[model samples]
Target chain A: MDIQKVTVAGGGVLGSQIALQSAYKGFDVTIWLRSEGSIERAKPKLERLRGIYKSTLEALKTDPSAWCRGLTDSADVPAEKIDELIARVDAAADSIKLTCSYDEAFGEADLVIEAIAEVLSEKEAFYAEACPHMAERAIVCTNSSTLLPSAIVGYTDRPGKFLALHFANNIWKNNTAEVMGQPATSASAYQAVVAFARAIGMIPLELKKEQPGYLLNSMLVPFLNAAEALLANDVADVETIDKAWMLGTGAPLGPFRILDIVGLSTAYNIVAASPDAANPDTTAGKIAAKLKSYIDAGKTGVNAGEGFYKYR
Target chain B: MDIQKVTVAGGGVLGSQIALQSAYKGFDVTIWLRSEGSIERAKPKLERLRGIYKSTLEALKTDPSAWCRGLTDSADVPAEKIDELIARVDAAADSIKLTCSYDEAFGEADLVIEAIAEVLSEKEAFYAEACPHMAERAIVCTNSSTLLPSAIVGYTDRPGKFLALHFANNIWKNNTAEVMGQPATSASAYQAVVAFARAIGMIPLELKKEQPGYLLNSMLVPFLNAAEALLANDVADVETIDKAWMLGTGAPLGPFRILDIVGLSTAYNIVAASPDAANPDTTAGKIAAKLKSYIDAGKTGVNAGEGFYKYR
Candidate 1:
């Protein structure tokens, strides 16, 4: 009943991270790509992940500041054991396998983690096809940012095994996994997922009930929304707003800086999802427009390297 | 004319700090207390402040953590300089004259900072009595937390000289001065106050328009409200909420911890002020009731050393 073999469907940013991170934590991970196009996209992503792990290991030896980078340390990794970590990552790389075929990927999966594109239809379609191919005891967990676990649980074969296993973007460094069960999900299934999250070196936060944005985003979004309102309403410029926040509260990063990291496209989508609050004068609409302008210019985020403030 | 003689009305926590800080920066300070009873309260407060300044000076020479305890810097000061800082505090204590008489306190004041109780009627009565005692051309500023600068400007003989000059609780380390002028506030009055703030070693943020909570609180209050809502609605516990925030975003402190520092009575009064949203099911009502119950038990905040979390 232990989750030894983990299959992560979707080889995008979070999916590749989940797959590589699972493998890095000693689980045999298979990343299922939708097609040759996605596989092509995933190759560079997986390669970049390798680079990230290498730099993270190197950073641990010299710079204390290096630890909080996207995919690295929360707890102190003793300097003496740095080589062991590098070796672990190397071994974990060996455990990860990528495939375009669902049958090959999900055949022996102890857990099928869906981290596909966020559209509900895409999720439902993928789940319908992938569920039948999953191993008999395989638990299904979706990494949907906005959609509830119940929204896609009906698409899966085992209702009792379906749940949400959410991760913050920088999986290696910001290692938080929020686990919540759909109404039909069994208590054992929830606990198993929680244990799996812990197995993969994540601090699992169990949400007792279903919350739309979960604990983190529910708190985070309003802050960002307020910041955006300040910017769009011309209350303050971006830099001033950032300075005020940094000075007032000793936060390491400002809201816009975080928005740049979170990706403007993703931010826009989140804003766009809430259409009821879309008047130009309203905060949500203004945020959407601001993000859309950046997105239109191909300045999506750190990946594209130009969001609120330009990145080199 | 240079702001040489500064008078701070009221000998409360912030008022005493303002007077002490102004004196530390070499401005002759006069503190106006209400009565002999308050003079007793002010005695221990002033004595404690002197002790704080001395320890802060001594701590600068050794520990790096002493900087933010209502004083600035983590740099190593030579033992000679530490003694000089202590001497300066003693000299500053010499420069600070205390009186219950408004006439004696304001006779030759260049700048008068009102840091009295928050109640508007209390402010109006104080201003009505004290305005006639002020030296001609002495700029007046109210350190009202939530009240508009316009609310009490009418009571001042020189409405053009009156404005809002708000400071955060721990004035020395958190050296921010939010200067906002009411409609009748003169441009020269605003500039002079800005210069005066700089003289006292403060970074003065000039708000072009009056914002009720000004810049910091406007951004901060919503974040706190959201956190309180989460706590009240049974979404998450305090520690988990704080952990999620700290881990998700690299903020130095969380909302509940901040509430603890801000004190529960102040927070309760803030929530209670908006009486329209008092339904039990609403987030605002839940927060109000939660704060009320805690305050009822006299578990007010860090001053009592037991708020959201017990402190030693």
Candidate 2:
């Protein structure tokens, strides 16, 4: 139950972050990629994260507001201690192991986190392939944002040890890990994941039962949908909608800005999949069309340098 | 037409705020109350606002972050200039006129803001009575959060000059004025209101067309309703839901805290009015019941010193 050797199965955005965050917290972490090409792609992400962490730590030395709760325990870290923390970031960045073999990654891992693609079939195949290689005591968690844990639990060898541990993007700052478990998931396995989440400096939002979109997305998705509805229905323009919410609620970013960061394609897919999108006259249908137009023009999101608004 | 002598009908919370904010910006402001009791009720609210403005300005002198954009033009005010600003607050506080006579309040008014009761009949009655007293050039705006401008435009003397100018609570800080107009509203009137909103230190959110709930409420209501559904459906507790959002988005307050500020009675009424609330098994019905229980126990909101959480 004492999680130490952590293996993140995928070297994607979240996978690399989970590995680096674990290693940064002094855990023996390894990233399990499917091929050598994946490792090559993941290396630059880790290197970039190292620079971000070091510079952020450097900023924290003078500016207390620059303190990222996920990066360090305290905002008031002493000058010498900050240097030690920066050293730890470099050490963590250099020490994390990356490999293509599941047996090598999972055989000794006390905790194995599945952070591969979100497709259900791909996740099922991953669980089936890696089930035999994982240690008997190893607890497996999927960082799936959309899928329910119960749907994939059947593929894993130990249903009792499998659950979902979802993290928001930019885990270093927006550090919230929603730990959700299926009916079959054991109490011990759930508690262990909660403890591990805290140890890595994430606020664990424990869900009592299986909820679609978990807790964060359960609230965020609808809020975003409503904003999109306003835009699609021609009630207001993009800036007007964003400004109203920002000025009224004192929130830093508005829904459209969040959608841009979330990626327009992801938003499009979610909207398109909704039942209301079947009718061309419906608001959801209109929104899907609007998103598709932007996406067709190559304005995917902040990743593409544009979406709702342009970024420099 | 230029807006100079402004009359705010009904000296309620938002009405007093609008009147005070206008007076602070050197406008000739009058608050037309219904009776002597209303004048007495409004006097204390205006007095409290004066204290809030002075203390907030005093705090802004030392703490730059305490600057309320609605209270002043800039955060970088010189030490000596702050004394002048405080003096202006005192002068504005004493100069705001209160009256029960429609002729005295609206005969020479360039702009009349209706911030009376939300009840439709009360608003219609106020408009009918005040129409004869209002100046021929006066532009009238309703500050109703729920009722549309079009709904009450027929009762007014000049439908061409009628529109909605909505303000959020705590006008000194949360300073957004949503300007929405019906189809019959003149372009000149709309632009004048937008200019007046900016002149009073509010970021004007101009709606191109008539939309129920306007801009802020249209977006905020759905977002709050989604959070309420989650709570009603037993997906998560209030703290967990709030923590997940605040940590994930870096928002200052979560949906529940916002609900508490918005007042549970308002939330209950909105939920109860929803068509889905007819079914007891529905989420809206469940939420209505939940909010009613809190309201019945005298835990109305921050005003009542409690809602979802204790205020003081």
Candidate 2 TM-score restricted to chain A: 0.95
TM-score of candidate 2 to 2 decimals: 0.93
* Predicted complexes: DockQ each: 0.58, 0.68
Over 4 Å off, model 1:
A68-81, A263-310, B69-74, B275-277, B296-298
Error of 1 at B252 (Å): 2.0
Question: In CAPRI terms, where does candidate 1 land?
Answer: medium
Evaluate residue A118 in candidate 2 and report its C-alpha lDDT on the 0 to 100 scale.
87
Interface RMSD of each: 1.5, 1.1
lDDT of all predictions = 0.84, 0.91
| Per-model TM-score of chain B | 0.92, 0.95
Worst 10 residues of 1 chain B by lDDT: B68-77
**How accurate locally is residue A1 in candidate 1, as Cα lDDT from 0 to 100?**
62
